[model samples]
Target: MFKYFFVVFCLSLFIRQGLALWCYECVSTQPGCGTQFNWLFHWTKICPETDDVCVKIIEQRSDETIITRSCLSSLRAIRTDIPADHYEGCRPAAKDVHLANYVNNSIKELDIYRNYYDKTTWCFCFLDNWCNSSPSSNAHVYLIIGTSLISLVYMF
Candidate 1:
């Protein structure tokens, strides 16, 4: 009985470690960043330990819109005013942030202009890697866990 418990515990640990949170990282100007986002063209990145959630930023100027996807920590650093309570769902921040910091502090070099922006709405999620993209993003993660459990069961 003790040996069985130890084996189960080890397998559980393995499964947990194999799964890491991933987010769709991209900007509106990039391919697949539009309304009909092409998943194949979108880049998925593992969320850093410091970023516990994925965030989507939508800034609407007079006649243009800008959309950006990144980890919560990244956006928080630039915006700096996201209320701690507004950690999930889509909503406009109480204040509008300037684009100067975002353009200058950006880690990626983009041909698309980011210097122009206005009122912004932010969305945050911790459900799955693509939670920032869609509601059904968690399915694949569940499937992976299911497969791992089956393999472990068959092993013993």
Candidate 2:
């Protein structure tokens, strides 16, 4: 019985340490810093509600813009100071001079809304240490069977 208890304890500890989840609000916040950051496995018990998740940023600018313009090269690093009132021209952080030229020159087909950050368009990730709250990762039914086999080994 002691041995069985030890196994259960170890399993519990392992499950606790197994995976971690992170969420980021890329457009609305600073780089790699925000309330959206979450440990997917643990947060459910603590908050039990909406928790923001991480993202992978992607750029659709022309090849020339990516190479020539420092700002366009790293989409993830764009500062979040874009003005709410401005819509006609480049939004500073979201702007690439080369991209503008590409569109003007007919080299790029312009889809203005596509450039902006939208939840439907943004990339998603299933991070390590994260699982949906419904069926906890600890719900592995085979764990007991594995424990029983290990205990049998000790009996021999």
Candidate 3:
């Protein structure tokens, strides 16, 4: 019975991990966008399983800076760097399925920046959760370990 419970618990964890690709979602017109202090009020957005990348964009204009974040299709996420003011792509936490094709078809037309608006600076990032922080993992792991230990203690 304990063994069965353990197997079920582990399987549930794997299932949860497989079912979701969470990302940060926010848009701010403030000057310092996505900085540590600015994220205090923002929340993480649970993205669809089909979306593999979390993208963050920072645009600096003469008057004000804007920050936006969302989950994107792997195709769109790949073209983070275009001839813009500023752009960067971070390594995805999970293996991207479209990476091979993107690398092979490195054409200028395929870039996402072609549609971008003019700006002083732009930046992008691909990460697991919000800004490289996986808030759920630590809690989930602790819960699993705590449950296992309790079960063992009760059994003994």
Candidate 4:
């Protein structure tokens, strides 16, 4: 009986690890950051298993504007911020760039855009598949249900 319980516990742990989070990846100055645009260049990337948040930044300057999207650690997700001007010789603190915990599960996305004239926007997404341009239908949910059913059968 003890051995059976141990096996079940180990299986649960394995299933939890297998259902890791992933976020959409893209960076562009044009309108379509996640989608395709005619003149914009976009790259495809997948966040590491350790990352739990997706981040997007849009900044405008005198000469040019930029937009970026990437994955961030859960810890850095709460405290993420971008300096007004890094190219203009403003050095930000080390902690400003690191990832942090997300504040709330219900709050899927956070938008921080202070300047209307420059139109700089910073967005962070904490929910699963929030950043994906096209997400598949409830795949993770099915995996969880399947695992639970298998576990129940084994126990019986």
lDDT of each: 0.68, 0.35, 0.50, 0.49
Q: Estimate each model's TM-score.
A: 0.60, 0.23, 0.42, 0.35
- lDDT of each residue in 1-156, candidate 2, tens digit only: 888677677767657644534222223133322223322323322112233233333333443111111111133344332223222222233343344333444435545334533212123334322222122343443565586678767755
What is the lDDT for 45 in model 3?
66
lDDT tens digits by residue: candidate 1, 43-149: 67777764378888888889787778888766666564465654678887554354344455455555233434567778888765577775544556577577667
Name the candidate, 2 or 4, with the larger TM-score value.
4
Q: Clash number for every model?
A: 0, 6, 1, 8
| Model 2 poorest ten-residue lDDT run | 64-73
Sort by TM-score, best first: 1, 3, 4, 2
Query: Which candidate wins on TM-score?
Result: 1
Cα lDDT for residue 13, model 3?
67
TM-score of 3: 0.42
TM-score pick, better of 3 and 4? 3
Clash total of candidate 4 = 8
Q: How many backbone clashes does candidate 2 have?
A: 6
lDDT of 4 by residue, 1-156 (tens): 865785678677657655554554555644566334322233434456553556555566675656556665432544346543323122332333324344344543533322322555555555554353323434554665686677677777
Please state the error at residue 110 of candidate 1 in Å. Answer: 15
Q: Give me the runs in candidate 3 sitting further than 4 Å from their true place.
A: 1-14, 30-34, 37-40, 49-51, 73-127, 132-156
lDDT of 3 by residue, 25-124 (tens): 6666543234442444555666665635566555554655555666654325454433332223532233224444535555767633333334423334
Off by over 4 Å in 1: 1-19, 96-116, 135-156
